[model samples]
Target: MPGLSPRPEAAAFLRRWREALIGACVAVLGLYWVIFSFGLMIWIGWAVAAAGVVLGVAGIQRARFRAGSDGPGVVRVLEGRIAYMGPLDGGTADLETLRALRLDPTGLPAHWILDRPDQPPLAIPVTAQGADALFDAFASLPGMRTEHMLRSLNAPGGASVIVWRAADPAQKRLH
Candidate 1:
């Protein structure tokens, strides 16, 4: 034991490529099954391969999200409700009651503006403590794309973005 020093090379390697490793493993397993098996096995392989590709793409997005900076407030989500408490402003929005979701980064601070019927809009900074969770919350909306939201979130400031909009025409659109 005195002459041996523990090596973390394997751990380091995995830490860097964990998602890609999983994706490759899934893809290889799927290909192996499809090539070596038949009938139902091939269908199963296709499922695995599809999942592998989806996971690989998600991994890349996740990496980009991890690079996002922590913004200027605390964001809390509960039972389809969201609340933002910041130094300059704070408000709450119910996901169930949400009529529209817009992003305005052109301002001094980027904001996720939630619009609800008969209620004032609520704006939460993009860098809020729990903003990352909004990625999933926003996705729950009909036809919301997590990847698109993430991309818009990381885009350079200057223009606003519409992350989600209800089918109801009453929903507001911020130009």
Candidate 2:
């Protein structure tokens, strides 16, 4: 007898969609409660189902944001700052001070150009270790469209695209 195992593609799909799968399960459970229960439980079930849908959508976005960790760097996001440690170069950028975000797909692995006023742009490879953290960081930017960012990320193009920009480029102060 031989042990059963998932194929490579199936395993990868599972790994990428693990959070979404959990969210779907939660939604199913909530729907079940909504169908079988009554009174306050039904309202609670509706809330639960809504929350699960939100989670599932976010999980899908996150899964799409993740490329791989085979690039030549490591990314770290802490306290509203993004730091990249690459083999040849590295830099840190404060999220609050960023002026614009661009995706340069001309490169082999592609690089995210984090631009700040009066400073050298920090370029982090999309496939760098922990690069997925950029999803949350970029999401925090006011007026950023997650769908646009995701589309630009996976789009086949040779030119760089601006994903986000500060409403008032001169206004660097948070307050």
The estimated TM-scores of all candidates read: 0.65, 0.88
Q: List the candidate 2 regions with Cα displacement exceeding 4 Å.
A: 1-6, 169-175
lDDT of 1 by residue, 27-72 (tens): 8889889999999999999899888877777665655554233568
Q: Write the per-residue lDDT of candidate 2 for residues 96-175, one digit (tens) a residue.
A: 88989999999879999999889889999999999988999999998999999999998987799999988885766778
Question: How much lDDT does each candidate structure score?
Answer: 0.77, 0.90
Segments of candidate 1 deviating more than 4 angstroms? 1-25, 28-47, 62-69, 145-148, 169-175
TM-score of predicted structure 1: 0.65
